[model samples]
Target: MAEQKQTVSTDDGLILAPADEKQNAVASELEGSGISSPAEYEDLPDPDIGKTDAERAALDKALLWKIDLWLIPWLSLLYLLSFLDRTNIGNAKVANLEKSIGMVGRDYNNALTIFFISYAGAEPLTNILLKHWSPRYFFTGIIILWGIIMTLMGTIENQAGLLACRWFLGLAEAGLFPGVNYYLSCWYRRQELGFRAALFFSAAAMAGSFGGLLAAAISKMDGIGGYEGWRWIFILEGLATVFVGCFCYWMVFDFPDTARFLTADEKLRAMRRLRADNQTRATEEKISRRYVFQAVKDWKTWVYAVQYMGVLCPLYSFSLFLPTILVGMGYKGNRAQLMSVPPYAAAAAMTIFIGWFADRTKWRGYSNMAVSLMGCVGFAMLLGSSTPGVQYVGTFLGAMGIYPCVPNTLTWASNNVEGSLKRGVMVGIVVGWGNMNGVVSSNIYMPQDKPRYLTGHGIVFAYMFTCLFGGTMVMHFMLKRENRLRKSGQRDHWIEGKNEQEIRDLGDVRPDFIYTT
Candidate 1:
């Protein structure tokens, strides 16, 4: 089919084509995108109106590099600490946290389950606070709070004490993952978000690698200060986290409009680029009850939530159990910790590459579906195989396949949502609901299923398969059909009588707000 010609309407409501080849070229860029009226068209000013294509590209590259240097590294460090602190219980378990605390029967699983209960419950509410308090203050406060909680965890003498610490830790950590994701959406364009999100998320993969090596080294510190190796692990890592959190107050930038690192020209371009990127809505908007209701009403929000749940279930299972799985593979003590590093290291490399690939191809759902299949195959191997070597290989495949899907899935959801408040609400709900899958993961890798954890492997395999066929594929087709309808002008009726503010407030409900599948 030929590209649809874009039109504008004047005060008299006369429809006309763009005046010249330049305006036509500009309009053609948003071809099939349902821009509601001439007013909405004017809102998305051409970023390259005066500059040559090469000049615009060069400037964009330099600006992105500056943004990346300031944003990605610090955010990645924060998440690295958060993930390490959250999952370090697994490492602590390997070092005999259960034996140390006299945890018996289901006590270990209960501890893990309690964390997620608090975590998922706190997630939706915490993102609201992120906007209210500002990223710098909010992140610094939570990071320090969690760090203190984690440090005290080292001193816990019993199961009750441990559970209490874990619960508070969950509340403190509830914000960081989803908070950083929403924060990223504030600065980057749709196409740029996936790769940046990947870079930030890959830090979690690196933390897994780092955690294993660090835990191995720390476990040797047993009896150094009348503390077990696991105790030392918590104390040292907690201190490091607190240090980073203190630095975050200075290092973390707020939104782009108020970013201190950018020049006046750079700030203007940053805002303009985002306006051009999201054609139908303002780049930034105040939080409103209406947006919260709109986000809750959007069916796409729930679909994304379910899709996120599918991937996170298996991802959590794999991350929390990999060391135990390796120990079951016959690697003992610190050696088991050492062996866990390779899978996460491989996963970190693969995640960054897949993120770049997804952004380059603009194939978020497709990338997720493909990776989900890889995860299914990996879990199938773990379920079917008897040999330790085969199961070890499965770990590599599982880590690599599952890790990348997170950033892709998140960016896919963020890409489709318009306006800041609505996007934040949608992301918060999706993340909160998705993280509830951690409960399922924590309980499934039962103590009875050790060595050949068949039941756990089978269930996680099913989850990954669901991510492939039931989640990403379904969402892809839904978005594709919506785009097709908008291209045919079938959705134009949505904007017929709305004024400019009404149209802007309608956000993605507007006909021309194209969906990125």
Candidate 2:
């Protein structure tokens, strides 16, 4: 009479039968176990259960590869449009946004801060919303809404109008990182998440690089029909977002269950694989508020959030001002825009290589730690030198070093949390917390302070130190926990039963949640 709700669970890969089929499923469960309630017998895992560490590791990598294919193009396009719209005003300043809108010093930065405030507020709600809605439609619609807002941003005539648009844009874009994190968890095991995240995360670099080139060309259209070239950046890119968002609605799969690409048998295999990989269904539980509140009180939440907070001071400060910094090298407007591309391109290159290596090695924390070192060194080199050749090289390295951590930090924190709701909430909280640093970043590079960027570099130097200290300690902490679990042999519990509570309490019980090598 109704469209039957087809389903699967990690416990048994077979499509879960309706109430009528429970007799059959129980018969099957009993066939091999010779036990009625699996709980009574301790529900020991099958002897032929999953691959060995090496084999499971390979499977994890393979699964990561699939998640990457689904995530990268979609997430990248979303962030590219989201970020391009957010920062295009920097490019717009080149085409006279300040003059056009009668904006004075600090007004633009203030506007950026306003966006973060709304953005930060909206992030937490995403974890709850993402659970009920199909990530495919939810993710697409959010981007489309933001895109519309971005296009509207182009028509602003005054400071208030521009500021209003930016605020609305932030509100619309808030759910993305948390939403995507929840989406990826539906597919990826913890170990493989970082590289996949990096792939999608690196889209920010592509946006930065291509954004400059496109904005430069668009700026040339300034005098046509009383519209500025800067305005066109918003109009064109925003429209592109709308188109892409709509397309993803048809293309993006909701979950393993709803994905038409997989066959019925394939879906069962997928669920079983995840079960062996130690992931329980994130979506099966009740709605997430009570769990979210508990998650907020956990120590790991603070630790993960703080680790990222350390990086945010440097990462956002660097990304937001990189183009403005390039303009100081005595380059022409077009040249400055073009110059922004190379350093970001280098970052993009670094992100891909290291991300792959991280995946292959299955060491999320270590990978991020090493890259953070590179970023620190790169930023340091850039800070100490003034020669154009050296400075240019330093900027490239700095970029290479800094941005790679973004996706890694996101993955690192996310992988540690269990449950769809808890992961979603924590991811949103961590990102929202990171955005707070932007307020500190906005004025760090004083209008009068250029060429040297003394204050800004000092801030970055301190933040990098924090990242090194916090990140290194956390990595060691993760490794120590992993080793302890291996020695004591409590790994089975992690694979089958433990949910959010177990994960939070016994960091060592990280069965297949490999510390990205």
Candidate 3:
């Protein structure tokens, strides 16, 4: 059908007569899409831009709930195993690697530091490597690899053996977090991405909960012949990871269009729908060094990297020391391990609740800032509390705060960019670089710091607060920038398919896509 010319009033009140009707021709061409005035098109299907103002507002709310079910359990499960497998050593420290492996003063700390160093160094590179590999196969292979290494960790005859295993494990598992973040962006609308990120991230909380149980149970295996229970922790948990990773390899969906589960129409709608949500050329793969260079060139890449590194310092440190902290609370090794569960359970609940709230409100920065403050307050209370009950409360609050911010911030930056190349490359750079904080955090809490944990807690609180302030500032700035673009009498700028893929697919017609704050 030939297109008919129509005059539409811009958001700024300027009347736009599409100089060429072919422009946004895709919008006009789509059936049931209602190319008429925004008000008349109340039945349109795009989730990002609903028929009318009221409808668009409503769909934004629905997107939040739509994504919640899938994001929560999947991420939580993955992280639980990853976190447990990574830090079960602290529990093992109490179990007797100190004796069996001849771990002397500071040897354990060095072992952890090795994990973080390799973790940090390899993170940035994983983001890049994921682009060339199918995320399903890549994560699957690596996860299985780490699981095997972790199982081997159970047999360490010396600290050097333990150290060698950790370094390799670090290298193997570096890509999952960033890959998950980048993958989520493919499905949800921008307003809904933060909380989805939060939900996925809360697995850290479970690692604490289930991890403690696993440790307590394994510690009992002390002489089930000759091998210590700590050895069991690594073996059982590593085996679990191998299974889960393999399961994901067999079942994980890549994209809506390619998803074996979705119907043809569903794929079309999913693709078209997201195009409306993000006015960027983000469809399909186009990997190249030029694209990688372009991603590196963006200022937000550095900003995101900095933000991630800052929070991770506190997070990794806290994960490594929870057992010690509980021990400091006066519980025996077994009981302290059990007690670690509650705080993380609380964190899991908070992460889901906060993520839902962020999606419901269509506000990313507010959700993250609030969570960061929660971390700060939680950390503060933890530092001051000598009472066991009060310390548990403080730990709960801190977990709540730290679990969600990085995911939200990472999504926020990713949503701002157009194109799969920029998003993938930049997400990798920022995510990989940000994780470098694990290196800083791993060493911060020395065994000598014990009870008060003054130096470690103090520095962690300081860094988190900085991220809170910095993330909030950047969020608002982006908000203002988006508002300016939206009101610039550029209606075409916001339309679907005018973005990166459209520019690439149809032509270089990058409608005035605006970045959110």
Least accurate 10 contiguous residues by lDDT in model 3: 8-17
Best by lDDT: 1
- Where in model 3 is the C-alpha error above 4 Å? 1-76, 279-283, 478-482, 489-511
Error of 2 at 151 (Å): 0.7
Task: Tell me the tens digit of each residue's lDDT in model 3 across 1-517.
Answer: 2222344332211123344753453444343232323432233335443366555445544543544454446655776787788888888887777888788888888898888778767766675576567666777778889999998998879888999999998888777777777777776656657777777777777777888888888789888868888888888898889888878775566655576655554455556555555323234556657667667776667776667766778778778888887777788778888888887888778877877776666566777777888899988987887787887788888887887776777877776776666676777777767667776677777878777677878888988888655756675676566545444544343444355334443211133344555
Model 1 Cα lDDT, one tens digit per residue, 292-313 = 8988999999899888988888
RMSD to true structure for each model, in Å: 4.5, 8.7, 6.3
Of candidate 1, the 10-residue stretch with the lowest lDDT total is 9-18
Question: Higher lDDT: candidate 1 or 3?
Answer: 1
By summed lDDT, the worst window of 10 consecutive residues in model 2 runs over 3-12
Global local distance difference test of model 3: 0.69
lDDT, candidate 1, at 323: 89
The CA lDDT of each predicted structure is 0.83, 0.68, 0.69
C-alpha displacement of 39 in model 1, angstroms?
Answer: 5.8
Which lDDT tens digits does candidate 2 get at residues 222-263? 878788787888788888888887787766777765667665
